[model samples]
Target: MIAQRYSYLSWLPLLLVSSSHPQWPSSWRCIPQPARSSVPCYCSGRQTWAGSLCGTLRIPGKRKRNEIMLRYVVALSLLALSWAQDCQVANINVMQNFDKTRYAGTWYAVGKKDPEGLFLLDNIVAQINIEEDGKMTATAQGRVIILNNWEMCAHMFATFEETADPAKFKMKYWGAASYLQTGNDDHWVIDTDYDNYAVHYSCRLVDADGTCLDGYSFIFSRHPTGLRPEDQLVVLQKKTDLCLLGKYRRVAHTGFCESGTSLDPQ
Candidate 1:
């Protein structure tokens, strides 16, 4: 049997405010509490009426249900507003006039700010290529240490879907086998020098509190040794612009992926 989760929302005071009350918060409104139920209710910003004194207004007949539905509609609207605000705050500016041709090549991940469920440990290297049909594809190899301290080389492949903006792409990626990584994620080229260095950003999930719950960013360089002094400063500024300055750690490429000892079956 399914329990009515929002039934407790019927206890709220569904007051009809007069136009004379001028100081009311524009975004705040009274919503009806649901009827009798044991299921707990929760909302963003601790807005739930649970464990609090909830007053009720006596509205007879169909008007009662209508008011309850209205409350739900308003709640959903506020949630959408919060989501939009989070996106605006978290957005990072991508490259302008980004040429996929120039960007295609083997690039090394010199630094990374990993998100939740990070699979790539170190020695991260990616080879980007443009297909005959002009589609962009990538193959990434990295060293990963999983549960019980088990270590292996992770080989990943990704196909990019172009957006209206040249620098923004939706990446669908999967590992060589089913036991490895798989997901569709945003892949934004935040800023890239094409040949020397590049900054990448991706936000996986946003919370109702107008914040990112999960996100990842990378600093890539053409040379295996790492970015030059001039390029490093440029990358730092771009990182600051993306709100990820000082949030990253250096990713070492010390032939860990090249070694055969931790190799996975192809």
Candidate 2:
């Protein structure tokens, strides 16, 4: 019987090549032997192929094929979703018609969302100035807590490199000494009311998964206490637009940076 089956299968390739319609339907099933015949046959539901002329064949597994296709589809969907989230975060809104001259002044950090390696902790303040060469520069001072619970007043300075857009800048900053913040980082002005409040953002690094690995944002106000109620609502809305809603903590200005006491890193 096994020899006879082998003989039947040997002619299958030739039969398939000679058939006018060689494509096999997915629903096809192989029958070992038909009810009225002593030969193997091919049947789909109630329909059977021509008698013993039908060759012995193995039908492919539909379930296995479906599983493989499903995996490919799921992987593509996840990749697309990751790209979309990255694009949404990258195309953030910024202040229109931002005048750097008008924007130059003292600003207080009223709210902050710190990322990894953040040097400034609280009592943050910044003073912006227009240099004689018409370049923008800033001095920022804040209270920082270092390793082993050591606290100190940190005075940092930054020079802005202008981009095509007036509202965006590349800030190169360093501490007054060797132990403070030092890096050239992207600085974007999300939105600013000039006199009342401002929203700033920085994306330090992006991950392979199309998400920000290290990023920070600051909500600034002209007053040390914090933003006014009306200004707060505007700043909060801008924060939400940047996808940073509920990520910030209130920054208190208790004159920590202004105190005469200063400690240098050992």
Name the best candidate (by lDDT): 2
Per-residue accuracy of model 2 over 56-172 as CA lDDT, tens digit each = 444434454445446767988966754564335457767788888988999999899898874788899999999999899998888888777877888888999999988889999
lDDT of 2: 0.74
Q: How many residue pairs clash in all the candidates, one count each? A: 8, 0
Error of 1 at 146 (Å): 2.2
The lDDT for every candidate, in the order shown, is: 0.72, 0.74
Q: What ranges in model 1 sit over 4 Å off?
A: 1-90, 262-266
In model 1, the clashing pairs are 7-34, 7-35, 8-34, 9-33, 9-34, 10-33, 10-34, 11-33
Off by over 4 Å in 2: 1-87, 263-266
Quote the lDDT for 153 in model 1: 83
Question: What is the C-alpha local distance difference test score of candidate 1?
Answer: 0.72
